[model samples]
Target: MKKWLYVLGISGSLILTGCNGNAEDTNAETENQAEEKTEEVNEQQVKKEILKAQMELTNTFKPYQQKITAYQAAVSAEEPDSETIQSTGKEAKTAASEAASKVEDFTIEADLPEDVNTAFNDSLPSLQAYYEHVESALNENLEEADFTSAEEKFTEFNNQFNEIIEKAGFPAAPDLMEEMS
Candidate 1:
């Protein structure tokens, strides 16, 4: 009978130990699940911040583009002095270049969604191309003899600039100005 009591006590202790181990295992699994959920939420927040920064960059481009367009209109209306037109074009190009640099700096450190990153990357080349076109237009010497050709080139550059804004999912310069007003 003493042996039987000893065996029963040992069996009860083993059962209690097993129950405690199971409870700990369940708590550990719950904690892991919670951590995973928190990580997902953080990733989503990062994506949101990235998108917000990108949109702000796009919006900033509009005003720079509008200034360029206005300059082009002024040049086309009359063959201004070659030096004056070139200076204005240079100033406009410099401003646009600065805006592009700011957009490039508007990056997020978080892992962005694949599609969003792809879309953003795709737009970059367009921005670069627009910059090159504008730079070329600004560098051209618009003498009396070449004024007509320069005007044509400037118009072409403006069209490319518009296309870039469209590809970047941004509104045209005029529309952005209207919205701002």
Candidate 2:
């Protein structure tokens, strides 16, 4: 009876230890899962920020595009109304200037990779330069305009924007140079 009791006691202790080991493993697994979930949530947040920044950048530039469209339509009119052309031209110039100013303020506050953030932040200046060029070219009370350099500047910005967004796991932005012409 004494030997039996000792054997039973040892067996019970072994069983209890085995159960405790399993509990520890379960706790570790749960921690790993929680960490993974948090990482996924953070990644999603970064993506959202990148997308929002892209939209803002696009929106900021849109007014200038609309004004350009109005100017183009006026210029292409059969009679080529000088009054309409001048008004639209001035509007476009103002829009470009406004866009340029806004671009400087349009920053991606996303917590992204350093390269991605730098690329995004750096690209905006090119867009600003594009608008500045357009503004300067249209500064004089304009009858006609040439936007070759401005388009080039825009292309530079667009390409950089596309690269950075793609790096951040998004598709390229729209090609706007043709529309500009």
Candidate 3:
């Protein structure tokens, strides 16, 4: 009887030890899965933040883009009127100014990834410069504007805008001038 009791106690001890080992393994696996989930969530959040910022910036400039398109169409006509050019130019300049101001005042969420934030912040100056250049070119004599300088400014602006979008992993801005012309 004593031998039987001793064997029963040994078996119980082994069973408890096996259960504890399995529990530890399960706990470790759970922790690893949780950590992986957290990392995935963070990556997704960063992407979402970048996408949101891109959309906001695009929305702010959409009206200005439309105005520029209209101006381009007006100037492309067979007999472009000087008066129409002047008025449209003024309108385009105003729209550009408004878009620039909106960009200047743009804000990003603090929780965004540092690289995304840096890309956005770094692009602001170029964006402002591009807008200023466009505004100045639009104010020039229409004949002089046709002399390559305006095209250069447009190209520069497109390049800078594309740079910003690319840095943020966003789609390039639509080339309204190309479409309208």
Residue-level lDDT of model 1, residues 1-181, one tens digit each, is 9999999999999999999999999999999999999987866665465556445644766677666665566577655665655666666677657755764665534356665555555555555555555655555642212334434543553454345345444434323323311
Cα lDDT tens digits, model 3, 1-181, are: 9999999999999999999999999999999999999988887776677667656666667778678656766788799987887778788888767766876887765467776677667666656665666667677754234325545655665565466556545555545345323
Against the unseen true structure, what C-alpha lDDT does each candidate score?
Answer: 0.57, 0.79, 0.68
Candidate 2 clash figure, as a count: 0
Worst 10 residues of 2 by lDDT: 172-181
Structural similarity to truth (TM-score) of each candidate:
0.48, 0.70, 0.68
Question: Residue 85 in model 3: shift from native, Å?
Answer: 2.2
Cα deviation in Å at residue 112, candidate 2? 7.0
* Residue 157 error, candidate 2, Å: 2.0
lDDT of 2 by residue, 1-181 (tens): 9999999999999999999999999999999999999988877777788777666656656767788778868887889988899999989888888888887778765567777788888887888899898888787537877777888998898898778666656555556444333
lDDT of 3: 0.68
TM-score, model 2 to reference: 0.70
Alpha-carbon deviation at 112 in model 3, angstroms? 1.6
The per-residue C-alpha lDDT of model 1 at residue 128 equals 50
Whole-model alpha-carbon lDDT for candidate 1 = 0.57
**Model 1 poorest 10 in a row by lDDT:** 172-181
Highest TM-score scorer: 2
